[model samples]
Target: MLHSIRAIVNGSTNFILTKMFDENLGFKEALLLAQQLGFAESNPTLDVEGFDALNKWTIFLCHAYGIVTTPDQILFTGIQNIHKSDALVAKARGQQIRLVAQAKKLVDGGVAAFVLPQFVLADNPLSFVKNEYNGVVIESGFADQQFFYGKGAGSFPTASAVLSDLSALRYGYKYEYKKLYHHEPNQLNDDIYLRVYVSFTDVKNIPTEDFEWIEQWHAQEDRKYLSGVIALKKLKTTIWWKENGTSLILEPDPIIENIEVRKLKKKAWNWLDYCRINLI
Candidate 1:
């Protein structure tokens, strides 16, 4: 049998809502059920990685533009790799990290969607959005830009948004959601700080040739300690070994090319594990 409901009403949308059904059920499971019921999709990537913000943005685009598109066509990035050290530095510098999902209408009658992590200065409105809160900014030629902010995730929050959409649909509002091919890839440009640990067989023979661009702040050869920051452009290659214990912090060069940041993240994670640093 096939069944459809306008929408479900709820109070809170926190993880607790999923827990009420099954102790082991999670947000992904609940979303999967909704997808199977034709209410959503099995977008494990977004639900697990927080790119669901982009999914919500895609729905909004369809409503505003009278067309259809999927979040897959948009640029996406998640904060799953952001380390505690980076967060600490951001806090020290009076900054906060935010998951920003955006959609823009191009001047030439095109649309764009993107989901990425951003470091917002303390003064930005985005910085004020705390955990699980969602905010959107809309722009149009006829009307001034509009901003909407509210509880973005959780079962109750999503239910509210769905109910609102259902109401519009019942009033004869018709919208088409479509999937489009996104040919344009997103290029990430940002400053990243990485903490690393290193060890060398012969401390005296350690080559500084590969790290000429790295700024050495302090070193203690007796304890085999080397901590510094290197510009991403200066990194020619990285070699790792279990025996060579090392610790260092690096900043991405302003113009880094030919390397995926994910590789750097893996290296950092390994170093952290070796150093027995608590990544969490």
Candidate 2:
């Protein structure tokens, strides 16, 4: 069975975010340019707020794994809450922030999905894709992994996709989606562990108890962030996570088992076979 599909299905917001990182443009400034260039609509609520990615994710689900789901049927997070500080933290660690829509086949044959912004490490292939380009990484038992990339938005980009469908008529093409009908039902759960970064304003209000083992936390008069591993479902139920002026990024788990960071500033750890500060 297919394991997972992680996609960046929205282009407009991606373009806007890419500009913010590459050019140091503010959110509104990048958004205006995205609109002027036709990458984004005048009202980009769907794109910026992740509804567009949710819709696209459902479509991909129907075709890839043959599961029917709607935007409201799943949990989703948008990119509007992202800050320049968030991107700076990622960049300082040689990473970039990207909006990701992910659908996974659970171990119990159940399905789960969500859309959120992620801090992608420089070594990840997804990190290379920027601007209006869209990428999908398909993980499966048989094939192991496969990645596909293309333009996911724009009039010409959309037109070309339609043209491909029209051209397929000569070869008789159709989506098989053989696994659509199944016993599994789509659901959300906290069984999955995630390494997350949470930013807060009030120094005294941060929920230190919510995290199982906090690896590192930064607090200042203006800037603050917490890094640790926690269950997604549990984090969602917290008021601190649901409140405004808060942001979260799920980081990849380290390769080393029971890894401990003693002095991150003095010594280097081979978490991804490179020099990286181990937050846990």
Candidate 3:
């Protein structure tokens, strides 16, 4: 019955992004404010680099789908590369940028998981989760979609969560970990495809050949942006995006199934064959 779980699990990054969106602040300025307010650590590598969200998502999978895995096993991208330009562009398109952690169960008993900065459309509930708030959406076959939202940071929320746990103990409550105990035939799968928006300072470094199909491209004197479909495995194997001034964010409804990718490839091949016969 479990289908997918998507959430913004890191409050610090969310706060930084919200400031960027609402006040037109740069990423660094917003991060500094979060640190000053005790919302982020002095050394915020874990949060800004997405390791924190990856940790939370790793645990979420274990509880939700009985799939146990480490952070290193999943492909994750942070908000470090984001800039004011990216935020402004998203706003122009009626979308917001959020650090999204997501996992979906495939029909083949596999689970696809990733943590990345993604474009959330205006109507998506996650677009409304701003500052230090967290929101989770769980989709299932029968229950449809359920959303859980709450304050996700600061001293009070931490204390509140602890107090709630203490109260549960008083009632002799315990975590059933039903999924883990029952066990499901699920393993991590990355042989998927995604539509992504990439912004880069250098065209050569962007690797245009890697994309399966490019839908949009914009080149400017200062920067370049492109949107295209690409194999998820290519992202997992490449580190080019992490170098220098480049940012990659998943396009809205980014996930593409394997069967769809194959179909597209087949169509491309058929078109190529027709062109070859006509030329001859």
Which candidate gets the maximum TM-score versus the true structure? 3
Write the residue-wise lDDT of candidate 2 on 103-178 in tens digits. 7776654566667788887877678778999988888999998888988778899789899999888789876665
lDDT of 3 by residue, 102-167 (tens): 999876558899999999999888999999999999999999999999888888987899999999
What residue pairs clash in candidate 3, if any at all? none
Computed on alpha carbons, the lDDT of every model, listed in order, comes to 0.42, 0.73, 0.90
Residue 100, candidate 1: alpha-carbon lDDT = 54
User: Which stretches in model 1 have alpha-carbon errors above 4 Å?
Assistant: 1-45, 61-69, 103-112, 138-146, 166-171, 175-280
Q: List the residue pairs that clash in candidate 2.
A: none
lDDT at 178 for candidate 1?
Answer: 31
What ranking of all candidate models by TM-score puts the best one first?
3, 2, 1
Query: What does candidate 1 score on TM?
Result: 0.43
Residue ranges of candidate 2 with Cα displaced over 4 Å: 161-176, 182-190, 204-206, 236-239, 254-280
For candidate 2, the TM-score is 0.78
lDDT of 1 by residue, 165-227 (tens): 999988998554332233332222223222232333345544554442332323433434334
Q: What C-alpha lDDT, on a 0 to 100 scale, does residue 237 get in candidate 1?
A: 33
